[model samples]
Target: MQAFIGASLLSSSAAQPKRKPFEIYDRRLQGFTLRVQSTGVRSYYARFGRNRRVVLGKVGTLAPEEARERCQKVLGHFAHGRHPLHGIGGTDAITLGMFIADTYTTWVKASRPRTAANTLEKLHRLFRTWYPEPLTAITLERIESWKARRLNAGRSAATVLRDLFTLSSVLRRAVTVGELTENPVRRVDKPRIDRRGKVRFLDQAEESRLRDALKARDEEMQKLRTAANERRQKRHKELLPRLTHFGDHLTPALLLSMNTGLRRGEVLKLRWACVDFDRRLLTVEGRNAKNRQTRHVPLNEEAMSALQRWREQSGSRRRLFDVATGFRTAWEKLLKRATITRFRWHDLRHHFASRLVQHGVPLNTVRDLLGHSSVAMSLRYAHLAPDQRREAVAKLNEKPLLALTMRLQWDGFPAGSHYRIDSMVEREGLEPSTPAL
Candidate 1:
């Protein structure tokens, strides 16, 4: 029904529908509407183009005059061939903060739960100044200026690049939802990252020390558990279970990652259903994997033993390792005890790949075992396989061609005179050294 929407008209029950909601068009302004629901909820809407409707606000929150002003602004933007949400002066214009808080937050939480919090935190922290600014204002110049500031403030190029990628992802999502015409971050030149930087893996001595430390840690934890159980028994309380297997999940978890090269998240999220004892295989489920593709890793003797002991201790729990927060404290202590420096948990995976490559395993095979999508990622360990390259070159020494050439040299044939050698070979009824031209 057409009416001059105001406080008196909005408060009247005669304008409301009985069964379903209905829109009341403004008599003074064309395409301005007040939607009155059957539940007595009223909201202002502005219709533009053929049927595009933009909600201004609810009745009680936005007064009639204010909603009318907003509606006029939206209609004016449309009349000038501009999108109300994209127009700077329009009340419905979407800001960076609004888009992220209202739209991107919910999506990233559901789609990328593992890194959702980190991504959101980075967006809020890194782009805090841009929060109030419009998404269209995130231009190449502003980002380059931000990049320069970040670099000057001691942030690495890799760190700045990661921040840029996160921002670009948000902008790309905005473009996908028609909020923006394009992602301006795409036009910005990405920071050059060194792909072949030095990989930090454990050496033999460091690995041995780390193993010793882990053993010591297990013994210490077992001793503490036994002491606690003994005290419990003395107090006539229910006796805690004795420590039979390894102390805690730390040792087994570390060993499993070192052996299987599963990522930290993948290991923590691993379920018992994915581990096959009979087949000696560990499956990384697609949902838990970083690449979102399932891949099975064969468990070696050490890996199998670690899982077996851990399973006995873990009982019927679904997850193999139920560590939600990770073992950072325990890992740090273990590293300090071992006197290892400049190594991260992720380096364990690199160590696994390095050992395989050094032992003559093919790079493609290592790539598959590490669950990398491409062999290019495994190339960092290529330098470790100097023996393999040496052997490849050594194979040339065993070729019959080498022997034949040496024999010809011993028979007084001058080197680098292929024409003369070919004529001599033809005269002597031997096959020509070179093919006839």
Candidate 2:
């Protein structure tokens, strides 16, 4: 049908078809169209080329005149041999929130299941204001201004850098999928950070206190379990198992991490099949590993003992630990009981690496044991192994054989007496050569 698409025609139900959908072509513009669905839903559209069509927006959301202006812009682009939706993936009207909700979220969830929730939440919280804005509207200047604000608000440079990185990743994905021509974040200067900052680990005194706390906790839990079982027996109920060996998974879990340097995720996701008692090795599956590569960590006596005790206690469960949620609450409680300050669960891994380095383990070996991708990461612990440097410097203090012989020849001379070189040479049972002069 050919007619002028006006506001009154759009608002009136007379133009809406009850049986089938229909399009009303604009009399003013050649390819402008208004599509009215059978259910009476109406939207504006622009038709270009042979069979191309672009839905501008719903009739109520965009007025006929406003849709007409947008349609003209799209048609003008098409006439100039340019893609009507060039920068955007398919539609010029896609906003940041729309793109994230409709596209990026699905891709990220599939590719990065472990961090998808946190990453998506951070994106939503940090860029909520930008949700209504189009992707192209996120310019370098705007990002720079945001970064400045965050810094001025007492956020650390490292944190601001991380935020920028996350934002840039989203924009980079847009560019990769043709939703954007370029990533403006590429032009923004990232905040500087010192990568080699001091690493936190437990000292001897703190480690001792932590061990004492663990032992105390286990004893207390065992007493409670005994009391509970006794009460159950008195009530004629099924007797729960007694607490033997370690109190719970927490003690063994901490020991394993401290010995093997496994990440918290890897430790939580560990399975009985991955542990090899005979080979004294624990395998981090590729799926659980951050780098997506399987790595075998050699289990020392402590790690092996922890795993063995845990297996005996946990029974035939497929996974080693039954912790569905993280250990944040339990960990904080344990740290408080131990009276250890400025330490984190991740510091257990650092403690393992630091101990190995202090014991004169090679940096390359430390890198492999820690599952670091490169030796450079393990270099942070290099200061712990100063014995080789000390030995090298100690060599400078040893007297040479020639110097020892020269000193012995002058040993009998009086204090502060000057000895001739020729006399000294002769005294040392050697021929004195004549000087050229």
Candidate 3:
């Protein structure tokens, strides 16, 4: 590297081998340096504001000539009497706190509660006492410095990703709303967090225990409903006991979810018209489902039986499962009383897949039943079948003769006939070479 007047000459094949906006701040580069990466990331100035050299944008869609033009325009604006970013917060003239707060207030209002709460949590956790003081100005380097701070803080990759996502949203929104000329958050690279938490699922024994517990609660509720009707307690202290009759209805809800593997939201929106008693099938329309793909799920006798019981109990020709019926909170209390503490209502759907994989179900069938957008998600239950680790291996073992003997399983598979091929090969006098070999 040679020092160019008020600058430095960095070889294309230098020790670092590549230049990013954050790296320029850590290294001793002279006045102005340019790093043009093959990935189309380009940044203009190396340094030269106040005792420290700083980098600008890593240009891509905007070419090098255009970047040079834009930088010159910025410099000329700074040189002239005009304050181009008069009210902006991150410039040499603006305090960092005002900038980020203003960024949050302006950009985050219309986001959903789930999204908004997440952003708020991440912002408070990651930036709380450590962000720039009110008087201190903000710089791009200060923002990118979060990469190191996040790692040292022992935050997992997901937490770091969430925090960075919040920052990216705020800054990107700033550019669109004309608060800032660009987004600095996008300029920085995202951190890699090793060892993400695996999505927990119910094993076969746990799934059965859960079902037995839920069934016991259901039976108790049914018995209570008959006993309570004779006494007639109004919607008061006795109101909850009457509501507890609704507990009988919970079995069908649980059964439907476990059988169909639909999201809780989709289940909450189910209607009588979607259920065909004669056919014993439930149809969820695309508009109601997350993937917007209509699914016709064949109901097991138990799932259908549960739905029938709900119809007899409610008597209203309205929605099958009313979210406002107060059973949402009721079921939580019921679980505590029942002492089934290992799962959420949503986990019932996961249990659906878990049970199927444990009993030799194909992953693609599980994916289709759950309405997953891809088999990659459904394949997570590979742990359920340690013998058949991946979908490819499982499919390689599958024979077309399965249609002849296997029936629909309770957990949602063509079950109990994993050895249909073995039977066929024995009768036909062919060796079962796949397993034998």
Number of the top lDDT candidate: 1
Q: How many backbone clashes does candidate 3 have?
A: 6
lDDT of 2 by residue, 201-226 (tens): 89999999999999999899999999
lDDT by residue (1-437, candidate 1, tens digit) is: 78999989976876765688888899999878999888978889989777778788988899999889888887886675444655434423688887887668878999898899999999988888888887778888998898888889999989999899999989988887667888888888888888767888998899999999999988998899999988988999997766677888899999999998989888989899999999999999989887889999999999999899888877879998888779899899899999998899999999999888889899999989888899998888899889867988997766455555665666655455453464567687864243223
Question: Using lDDT as the measure, what is the rank order of every candidate, best first?
Answer: 1, 2, 3
Q: Write the per-residue lDDT of candidate 3 for residues 36-69, one digit (tens) a residue.
A: 5545454655343444323444544444444444
- The lDDT values for all models are 0.84, 0.83, 0.61
Show where candidate 3 strays beyond 4 Å.
Answer: 1-155, 178-199, 233-249, 273-296, 325-341, 389-437
**Worst 10-residue lDDT window, candidate 2:** 413-422
TM-score rank, highest first?
2, 1, 3
How displaced is residue 5 in candidate 3, in Å?
51
Off by over 4 Å in 2: 1-42, 45-55, 58-92, 389-437
Q: What is the C-alpha RMSD of each candidate to the true structure, in Å?
A: 8.1, 7.7, 17.9
